[model samples]
Target: MGEPNEVAFRLTRRHSSVPRARAMLHAALGDWSVGQDALDESELVLSELVTNALRVRVPGDRQVGVRILLLPDERLVRLEVSDAGAGKPQIQHPCEDETGGRGLMLVEALAHRWGVEERVGGIGKTVWAELKAQFVVPAPAPPVEVPAAMVRPGQCVRVWGCWRTALGVRGDLDADGALHVVIELDEGPPLRVRSREPLTVREAGTPAAHEAAEPTPG
Candidate 1:
């Protein structure tokens, strides 16, 4: 039963998109033959994980994401909360009066099983949880087809073949030479990135490529 029966998303859990997540979940899992209670539980799990990721940011930084993966057979759904940090979540049972300290506990009670695993790029981790549902969710909507060589705006993108180098040059400069690395991804959303670290601008396509390095401050 180790088939690739899974759908996962990799979005940053930033402050934005919090309100829309619920509806998105419904859109993703609405067709499945699952109970409303199960859907509620899954949404709760996603919120818990996504909130934890959001808390990682300080006064600065934007929102990240929590991806809901509908397992094959539509029998189970996987919730993965990813972040840009090195840490694992622990489940704690708090007292009745405790206002907090009971998120993971809720997940523990709701999910069939949950655990954490390292992410692919060797940066963060994915807090995974599974809920029973039996989603014979009809054949997944036919994938929106597009020519291989074309990657428009608003699409989930990943860069494949690429190379990067670190060159050091000092002296502060204005936005004169600064360049905005914007890629038009046709499908998901436009990536609006403003950062201080090395940026990675990528688009959808075979052998996808991304430019490394973030925009520096003036």
Candidate 2:
């Protein structure tokens, strides 16, 4: 939640780049620990945006620009597609039998907010959409040091502000005799942390220590 993560890719104006754009967005969202709902919606939005960009008639050398921004604190994901075309995209209401013209309608339905902005010092504009990110609750941390002997698989532990399940203990040990622990998180790839690292663990059917609040006056 400190600083937002941003990634940008220059894409050729071709239909083939649409899937590639979606794939890059998927990988970026996975790294950001975005919820599946947001991820799916973002991919759909990216597809529409990139398709529009590819359809636009830009200068021969002008490449489409795709950028994704993740704002953890605000829980917002923003996507932008840029092209050098002179015309701005507009939503069209097509008849039922029409097979096209529903791109912007779908974007309007799924995104929290969307709009187009003129590119700075450029001949074209950038169409953007933002989706609210849904994040998973992290596991609670242990109040005191958890003995390595007591750690085991299927246990939830807090690491880097996210709750993750312990997969297993790696055979290798650190210089301090702490074991390298493998963990499965709600998002992204598996992680490895030292056993001695301070972590919050989840006990079955019990509330985390931090959830205990002072009792109200009777």
Best by lDDT: 2
Per-residue CA lDDT of candidate 2, range 1-218, in tens?
Answer: 57989999999877789999988998999888888999999999999999888888767678999999998887899999999988778999999999999999999999999999999998789999999999766665533336443556777655555455666645456788867665555555666655555455665334554533222111
Q: What is the C-alpha RMSD of each candidate to the true structure, in Å?
A: 20.3, 11.6
- Candidate 2 minimal-lDDT segment of 10 residues: 209-218
Where in model 1 is the C-alpha error above 4 Å? 1-16, 58-63, 134-218
Candidate lDDT scores, in order, read 0.57, 0.79
Error of 1 at 205 (Å): 40
User: What alpha-carbon RMSD in Å does predicted model 2 have with respect to the real structure?
Assistant: 11.6
Which pairs of residues have clashing backbones in candidate 2? Answer: 141-200, 142-200
For model 1, residues 168-217, the per-residue Cα lDDT tens digits are 21223347754333433333333333223233323233232233333321
